[model samples]
Target: MTARERLRDYHAKRDFGRTGEPRGRGAAVGDEPRFVVQIHDASTLHFDFRLQVGDVLKSWSVPKGPSGDPRDKRLAVPTEDHPLEYEEYEGVIPAGEYGGGTVIVWDHGTFEPLSHDRKGRPVDFAESLDHGHATFRLHGEKLRGEYALTRFRTGKDESWLLVKGSADHARRQGTPDPRRARSVHSGRTLAQVAGNS
Candidate 1:
């Protein structure tokens, strides 16, 4: 198959995985399912975590940021998928970019959506989300397992809390900082990965 065809299949099959969006100049990437959760240490000092849900990536900008404590609920405000180029963005985003700040992929890894409602009946993605509980399993270097974010049906995008449900990955606040989170990438820190930014 041609390169474009290969990429299409890659995106189709590995639609959820996170890959470096080459910018300026870089190497060719592989084809595999990708799901990323970048703890971008931006100038604003907030963490940005994103996951490829379907076509467009699901995103969140967390301030005071991700606490490992399963009981501690962090605010996760949803946003749009920055162009794939954003995957590699670091340093300073010119003045017009969406976030426009120093970027750092604090932590990332592949994720799996957990199915079920509070009552434990196979819940659909849309249905669960509509009611304010999009639980899922995460297999990242830092965070993992049944997580939920109660979305405010009547409030603006500013209404959500990243909560952890009963799962294999649960701990205390800042117990596992993203900096300490082993990288799936080649021995490179998210900052180093985006350092060139």
Candidate 2:
């Protein structure tokens, strides 16, 4: 399906009139795969993880943010496809709206799929995601090196685990204490961002 068609649920959940979020009307397929992590201060604070595929961004709602330790498995609940422009979204959603809260661009970067074939060739990222597993190397200001997402058996399709992979570039930056993390875009804390909105 086209990216526009894939964002039906996203559009349906948000009202552009009340929120400043982009209407997502003109999405174009990007040349390279990108990744974004947005710290969303909704009723429940969580991190929105997104990966570019085709013209849409496959997303997940990570409750405790991401970790840099291979042993740390963060719970990731899959969400709807978001528009590519949504990667730059960092503001407030009005009260009573679907995801009424403040948002901050925690990290934005490009990534390369690390899944490989039996012959040791890189496998398609989309295909890896379809098979419920994907390993990638992220090149971001704060997060570097390999990470992985693995879908565990759950009756619902949304359950997945975000894990850090052992890589030379991977550091011991265990999950940022959410309380102390600041936005990469604005250098503001979640409370500061929320109060300003």
Candidate 3:
């Protein structure tokens, strides 16, 4: 589907005049697919993980955020498709609006699709995701290394697992405390961002 069609749900849930979030003009796709992890201090704090697929960013609300440790299986709940411009979004979403909260760009960078088929043939990244699993190597300011998102459940309680790959970049250290983690874009914590807004 085109970006406009994919973003219908996103647009329906948000009011552009009330919120500062991007309305998702057709931004140019980059050479490599991009990924962003944004910390949102909404009703319940969570990390917003987004991966560029075609013209839109397929998003997931990762409760504990992505980790560098392969042992940690982070729960990722699928959300709406976001605009490409959301990668640089960092500020407070006005009160009473959809997803009203403070947001900060925790990590943003390009990713190399690493999904492969049963016979070891490389599969299209979007196709891989449609099949409920996709692997990729993230080259971000803070998060570097390989990661995979695998769907564990479907239907009413759909969810996916975000886990780091057991590679050279894997470390014992997991995700940091959400409250203490600072934005890689502005080097500001959630509290600071909320305070400024």
Candidate 4:
């Protein structure tokens, strides 16, 4: 099973609030994983949202970035699932292409999900992303909390918000200040690393 494949499976049964809206490509239908997330600062200024599903990555692009708190809605737009290999995607995306600009693996790590279906067991992430609210219980050293990905609009995979819905006393329950999260690629920012690596 690939991420793209799983994404397709999840949607086959998803209500999506409407029909034929192209919310996602409805690729491979498979099981969505728990606590899996990857952030990619794209060729443009947008940040990519990726959750593990099957063998590929269920993806989206966030413009404002991830929130550390539980109140801020950091718009997350839905996008097609990229191969797991995409986790390593960095640099520029050519000058005249679909996304022509500089793409830096600004930061990369993992995230845990805490959302469940109406039954409250755990959400089958792959299929549930279309539900519009993805509750993530992050376990990463840098980001730890009960967070969420909410759909804010219906633009070109560039129209959603990654909202931090709630948090425990250990984590902020709202928006996180960028200064609080140090880059995870280690000591350097993505650009610095790309230049040197």
Estimate every model's Cα lDDT from 0 to 1: 0.55, 0.85, 0.93, 0.54
What is the RMSD, in Å, between candidate 1 and the native fold over all Cα? Answer: 7.8
Model 3 weakest lDDT span, ten residues long: 167-176
Q: Is candidate 2 or candidate 3 better by lDDT?
A: 3
Looking at model 1, residue 196 earns an lDDT score of 56
Give TM-scores for every candidate, taking all chains together and pairing residue i with residue i.
Answer: 0.65, 0.92, 0.97, 0.63
User: How many clashing residue pairs appear in each of the predictions shown?
Assistant: 9, 0, 0, 25
- What tens digits encode model 3's per-residue C-alpha lDDT throughout 85-170? 99999999998988999999999999999999999999999999999999999999888989999999998888999999897567
RMSD of each: 7.8, 1.7, 0.9, 8.8
TM-score of 4: 0.63
- Name the runs in model 2 displaced over 4 angstroms: 27-29, 154-157
lDDT of 2: 0.85
- What is candidate 1's lDDT per residue for 1-197, written digit by digit as tens? 33333235224432232323332122233342234655554456567766554333456777756666777878888764433434544444533344444455555666656668568778766467667677777666667666676776445635688877755555765534545443444455545645655
Using lDDT as the measure, which candidate wins? 3
- What order do candidates take by lDDT, descending? 3, 2, 1, 4
Candidate 2 lDDT, tens digit per residue, 1-197? Answer: 87769999999998888999887776665666888999888899889999988777899999988887777789999998998898888888999999998888899998888998779888889898988899998888777788899999566665999998866545666667665678888898888887897
TM-score of 3: 0.97
Least well predicted 10-residue stretch by lDDT in candidate 2: 166-175
